[model samples]
Target: MSVSFHLCQPGGGASCGACCGLYNFRDHSRAALTRRLTAQTERLSRAPHTPEAYGEAARELTANRDAPALFPIVRVCPLLGFLDAEHQRVGCLGHPRVTGGVDLRDCGVYRATVCESFTCPSFGWLTDAQARLVQAACADWYLYGLVITDVEFVRGCLKLLEWELGGPASPDVLRERPDSLAAVRRLFALKETAPGRDGQATVFGRFAHDTEGEPTPRSLDYAALGTRAAPEDDVVLCLGYTPPDAPALLAARALVRDHVRAVAATFPA
Candidate 1:
C-alpha cells in the first residue's frame, strides 16, 4: 500500500509522547541520557536560529537538561510528562517548554529523532476522521486510546475505502468521497447492532476488556506482527478509547469492519 508521512500532525488531542513509557525508555541510563541530550542540543544548534535565538534555546535546553536526573530509576521514560492536570496531553519533559506548550518535533530529543522516523499504526492506518474519533473517545488521561492491532485489518479497511472512493484512502480522500463517511457510519452501526453478541462486537468487546485487564488476543497478535517490522520494533494498534455513545461506537465499528473485512477478503479460501 502507498504510504505518506507528510500528513502526519497532531490529531485526536493525542501527541507523539502518548506512546512514551517503559518501552520508549527501556535503555534509560546515565550514558544514554547524556547522548540524548547531546543530540538534542546539536539539533537545536543546527536549527535556523540567530545568535540570540540560539542563546535562548540553549537556556531552555539547560533548564531541562537534568530531566534524566530527576526521575527515579524506572522502566518508564522519564521524559514522559503531562501538559495538563487531567493528563490528557502528554509530551517530553526534556524538550524545550515554550510559552504555549511543547512542540515535540521542534524541542523533544528522542521524539524529534526516533519517534519522527516511526509512524504509529494509527497514523499509517486510520483516516484523519477515524483517527480523530478514536482520539476524542479516549481523551482522558487514564483511559488509553483505542489501538488497532491487526495490520491486515487496518489494510483491509483502507482497501474498502479505496474501493468505495475510487482513490487511495486518506484524510484528503474523504473530501472527494463524502459517501465514504456513510460506509464508516455503517461500520459503527454494526458494532451496536447486537452489542457483544456478534463477532465484530466481540472484537471490540475484547479490546475494551483488554484495555482494563491483561492484553487481549488481538493485542498479542499486534505485538507479534510488530516484531517483524524490526528487531527492536515497539508498536501496536492502540485505539486508546472505545466510543462513548452508541452513535459514535457504531461509526467507529464501521471503520474497523471495513478493515477487518478487507483482510478477510484477501484470504485464499
Candidate 2:
C-alpha cells in the first residue's frame, strides 16, 4: 500500500524523494546547502539557551534582521522544504486538509516504508512498548489533528523524538507552550481508545508535496487504507510520546486516557 502524499500514513512504499534526481526535489537539498554555506563563520555565533535570551533573538528577527525560523537554536542541520526562501511561514505538507491536490509517490520518505524503519535514539524508550507507543502517537498527531494535553515534560520528549526521527528538530512544534510536545506525545499514544478505522487515518505532518508546488497534490487513498490494516500485535510504533522506562510508560498510558476524556468532552462527533 502507498502512503498519503498529504498526510504521511502508515504503509509500505517509496516516494520520489528517495530518488531526488528522478523526482522534482532534486534541487531542494542543494538550495539549502547554499544558504548554509554563506551563513557560517560559526566561530562568531552566540548561543542562547535561556527563554529570556531566546526572546532577544526573536526580537532581532521581527525588528532587525527580518529572518525566519523564530526560536532558540535548532540542532537539526538541514531544515528543508520551507514555504519561502527564508522559511518564514513553515508548512507541513503531511496534512490532508492542506495537500489534497498532490500525486502518489510525489514525495520521498512519507510515502515509503520509512516509518517502520525510522527510529530516533533520543526516544530511548526504556522498554519496547514505550518506544512503540511514542512512534505511533507522533504519526497520529501528524496525520490526524489529535491534540495531547498534559503537564509532564512530554513536549521536551516530543522534540527529542522528532529530532531522532529526522524531522527539522525545530522548536516550532512546541508553539510557545512548554508542554506542547507532551500533548502531542499523549495524543499519539491513545490508540487503545481509537476506533477500528481511525488507526489507519493518514497523518499529513510527514509529507507536504502540495506545498512544494507539485502540479497536482496527491494523498494516500483513504478508502483503501483498510486494506493495509496492521496485524493484531505488531504495533506500528508511530503512536505517541512514550517514556524511556517502565514506570514512565505506565504514567504515559494514564496521561493518554486522561487526555482522551478532555478531548472527547470538547468534540464528540
Candidate 3:
C-alpha cells in the first residue's frame, strides 16, 4: 500500500555526494533537521483527537519549495507525500492551505510497515563516541521498541520476517532463540539517546537480501512519521513487501532464504 518516488542525482559521485546513501552520510544539510522535527511534533502538544491532525503538521514542512534543507533534492530517497486530509493531521500549518489532497489511510510513507519500522543511523550531538555508529548500536533497542509496540517485539518481528522469507512462524518456535531478550535489553541499556556531537542510533529499519549481495531497505522517511532525520541505501529482502512495483513485490518475495542461516544475514557487524 506504499508508493515511493526515487531519483538519483548524477553529481552524487562514487563517494555518495548528496546521493542519500543508506547507512552512510551521503551529505549533510546546514539546517538542523532534528529541531525542525521537534517543532513539528509539538503540534500534538494539545493531543490531537485524530491522525489527520498529525498529517497536517507534517505537510506544513513539506510545502517548502524553496528551502532545499527542508526538502532536499535527493537522488535516491523515497519522498513521502501526505495522504488525503482525513486523519486530522493535515492542513493546519498556521496558514491557509489546500485540503482534500489524500487520505491518511493511503499515505505513501507509513502505509507499509517497512517505512514505519526503519530508523536512520543518526549520530547526532554525541561527543563521547568516536563514531556515531557506536552510539547507534547502543540506542537501537529503545528506538526499535518505539516503532513496534507488540509485547514480544523482536520475536514478533522475526516471526513475521520468517513467514515473509518464505518460511512459517510456528507457534512452538523459540521465543528468545535469536537474541536473548536479556541480551537485547542489555544492548538498549548501553544506548545513550542524549543530545551530543556524536549521537545515538541515526536510523531504524528492515532490509532484504537482494539478488545481489545487497540489503535492500525500505524508505526510512521519518518526515512522514511526523519526525525528521536528515537522510539517504540499497536493497534487502524484508518480510514487508512494499516495493513501488506491486508486481515486483512478489518477486522480492521469491528470494526468501529457505535453507539459510536466517539470523546470520540479518545481524551484521
Candidate 4:
C-alpha cells in the first residue's frame, strides 16, 4: 500500500506544494495563495537568471510577505510558484526543468539539494490507490495539495465509509466506480466546501499552532461539549472545526457524518 510514484507533481491536473509550506500561512485561502504564488512567479520571472538577482528578489518577496506563517518553524520557499502560463499548476520556479537547465533553487530559502530530495509524509503514508484517488478527485492545485497532505482527513473519510458499509471501503473500489468516485470527491471536497471553517486560518485541519507556533494535533474536549467521542470526530477536527459548545460539536459531527454517508450510499449493493 505504498506509493511508488511521486505524489508531488503527478501532472494530470494534480500538483502539490505543501512541502514548500504552501499551506503554512495564516491566510491559506485559495485566492490568497493564488495571489501570493502569482506575484512570486511574476516577480521571479522578471529577475535575471543569476543567483544574485534571484537572491535579491527572493529576499524582497519574503520581506514583503502579506501573511505570517502559521508554524514559524516551517520554511516557506519563495521559489514555489505557478508552473504554467495559465497558472494552473504550481512547482519550483527555480528548478532546472523550469529555469531552462539553470538550477537556481539555491537562491530561495532552501538549497537545491534539500528541495530536490525532500518528500512530504504523504509519499510514505498514502497507498498508491489512495494517492491516485486524491489525484483523480482533487485535480486542482489548491485542493489537491490541501487534501492529499492531510493523511488523517483522507483516512478518516474512508474509515467512516467502511464503518457505514460494514466492510472494507477500498480506495481502488472508489476509484473504479465513477459514482463512488464522485461521491468520494464530494466527501473530500468538504475540505473547501465545509461550512463555518472560515476565520480559522490558524487551524490547519486537525492541527493548531502552539504558543511557539508549532502545529499540534488537536482533540475535542468531550467533557466540555457534554458529549462522548464520536467516530466523526477525526474528520470533523480535520475539517478545521473548533467547536465551542455542544451544539457546535453536534453540528460539526453531523456535517462529517452526512458526507461519509453520502459516500457509503454510492456503493453498489
Whole-model lDDT per candidate: 0.38, 0.29, 0.28, 0.89
What's the CA error at residue 258 for candidate 4, in Å? Answer: 1.2
TM-score of 4: 0.97
Give the true-structure RMSD of model 1. 13.7
Q: What is the lDDT of candidate 4?
A: 0.89
Regions more than 4 Å wrong, model 2: 1-81, 85-245
Lowest-sum lDDT 10-residue window in model 4: 193-202
User: For candidate 1, lDDT tens digit of each residue in 1-269?
Assistant: 33343223244554444344322222333345345534444545344434345445545654654433212221234344444444444444444452224343433334457654655566565555555432333333222222222344334445554555455555333323435344443433332332333223223322332333333533333333232221111111233223334444444445454543543333323
Best by lDDT: 4
lDDT of 3 by residue, 19-130 (tens): 1221222112213322332344354333343356645544553464223331222222222211123221211222112223423322222343443344333212212221
TM-score of each: 0.33, 0.23, 0.24, 0.97
Error of 3 at 20 (Å): 11
The model with the greatest TM-score is 4
Lowest-lDDT window of 10 residues in candidate 3? Answer: 7-16
Q: Which lDDT value does model 3 have at 29?
A: 24
lDDT for model 3 comes to 0.28
For all candidates, the clash counts are 20, 38, 49, 0
Q: 1 or 4: which has the higher lDDT? A: 4
Error of 2 at 183 (Å): 9.7
Instruction: Report model 2's TM-score to 2 decimal places.
Output: 0.23
**C-alpha positional error of residue 118 in candidate 2 after TM-score superposition, expressed in Å:** 17
